[model samples]
Target: MSRDEVLVSTDWAEQNLNTDGVVFAEVDEDTTAYDNGHIPGAVKLDWRNELQDHVRRDFVDRTGFSELLSAKGIGNDDTVILYGGNNNWFAAYAYWYFKLYGHSDVRLLDGGRKKWELDGRELTKEEPSRSATKYVAQEPDRSIRAFRDEVVDAIDNQNLVDVRSPDEFSGKLVAPAHLPQESAQRGGHIPSAINVPWSKAANEDGTFKSDDELRKIYGEAGLDDSKDTIAYCRIGERSSHTWFVLRELLGHSNVKNYDGSWTEYGSLVGVPIENPSEQQEA
Candidate 1:
């Protein structure tokens, strides 16, 4: 299979649409996008509702996850191909969540829905109905995620990346003006974390850059395979996109997604925070 184990091209996805055991999913920040039009037969995974805990700032519990999968007609052994509208941001987060729960065969749709739509691939409003399945969730993998303490420990020792935009990194904005829900009490990145916006790794069309380009992009920014790397964004969605780029496309080992991200990091009192604008003024 020429397809990278973790990523599939648009051609691959289109060719496999009718393939047995392959389930296509669209994970989006905007719920209506899927209803508007999506890849034919692709089911919807709402980023806020399906993958998150209803009452907590964490992911769904194992039972909740299993139920969500079952409700989505996903068998534990089935192949899942995920894509999204917003440059694959939510799709990559979904990918990270599935990996944490040990879904063995999930793959990201390369370039995601942007590429699919830009290529003028057919979109359908019709929904697919698959038989409901009974899925058993695995124990969550802690190695792929980081909590506040782990991030505090990582300040000096690990490759901590802040994948939010420059404004967010500089404390000029807590979250984008449009997303008041993502705003944090604090607006700066973790102290000593380097700012590398998530979109830098992708082209204008949302496809990832070539491998050599990717190597130069991160390597120049002091990221490499040698150290364990942690990436974070406002609430970890954008950072998960960078996580996908580094861990899957670039083949870096020991990459973890700090899913709690800035939301958790910023709210903590007495934690070291960095504001580039402050440093510049000083």
Candidate 2:
């Protein structure tokens, strides 16, 4: 999908919140903040909270995922728009999940809450009500997803892009402080995977940078759109944003998101981690 086709602006949403067949989902993982205020007519869902059952290190619990989407008034053909407090962080993951379940016509709100609040847009304190609907999940496109088994196969077959901070990629750290360290389960990135942190795709204000800038950044990291790229970060959140850029924005046809990401891969039966100095000292 083209960048223009996949991202809607806050201005557009402000004008069309109640448009027919268009639904706004505010995937603001922070419930307290969402309760205080959110886009008027927007529905809220926490990526993890709505999940029914996730095996340690997996993205979504399949049967449970279908049920959650069905209960949220989301259907296969609806035009779904997503946003959140963070610069499309959880929003991107939500988008990926919906797409995985065969939902077409999904888009992310560009700039997200930062841009909305910056524009002095009005927000609502009322919580959105859930509406039940029927949804059909199609066969998952395995190419756009990754599992522990595929990851091992990818070690020599494709380019694995570790979209985490340098420290985390180097195995110096496991988890972000807000989450438990034990949640990481293991400590490193896929072997030979290039390190290109997800923050490289956005600016301090949470809005994405210009296309020229993004192109240069990805190019410098040896990430070319022509190659098959698989991206992963802790729990698959950050990498989803990168996946958006590479797949939706840059139009890389072979881009995939390793939803299992570091948490799953690290804790797998046994995967080796390479320290930063170990690479340098080599």
Q: Residues 1-282, candidate 2: write the lDDT tens digits.
A: 667789988889899988878888888667776788989888778776674244653555566667777888777778989888767888998888777777789999888888889889998998766578877776666767877777787775777899888878877678764565665665667887989888889988677777789889888987756668889998788888998988888778888898778877877776756667456656
Model 1 Cα lDDT, one tens digit per residue, 1-282:
123888889999999999988999999977899999999999999988878888978889999999999999999999999999878999999999999998999999989999999999999999889888999989998888888898999997999999988888898888865676456677788877888899898899988888788888888887756889999998889999998888887777788999888888888889998877767777
What is every candidate's alpha-carbon RMSD to the true fold? 1.8, 2.5
Best by lDDT: 1
Question: Which residue pairs collide in model 2, if any?
Answer: none
Worst 10 residues of 2 by lDDT: 51-60
Error of 2 at 160 (Å): 1.1
Candidate 1: where is the Cα deviation over 4 Å?
1-3, 177-182, 279-282
Task: Tell me the number of clashing residue pairs for each predicted model.
Answer: 0, 0
Deviation in Å, model 1, residue 94 alpha carbon = 0.4
Worst 10 residues of 1 by lDDT: 176-185
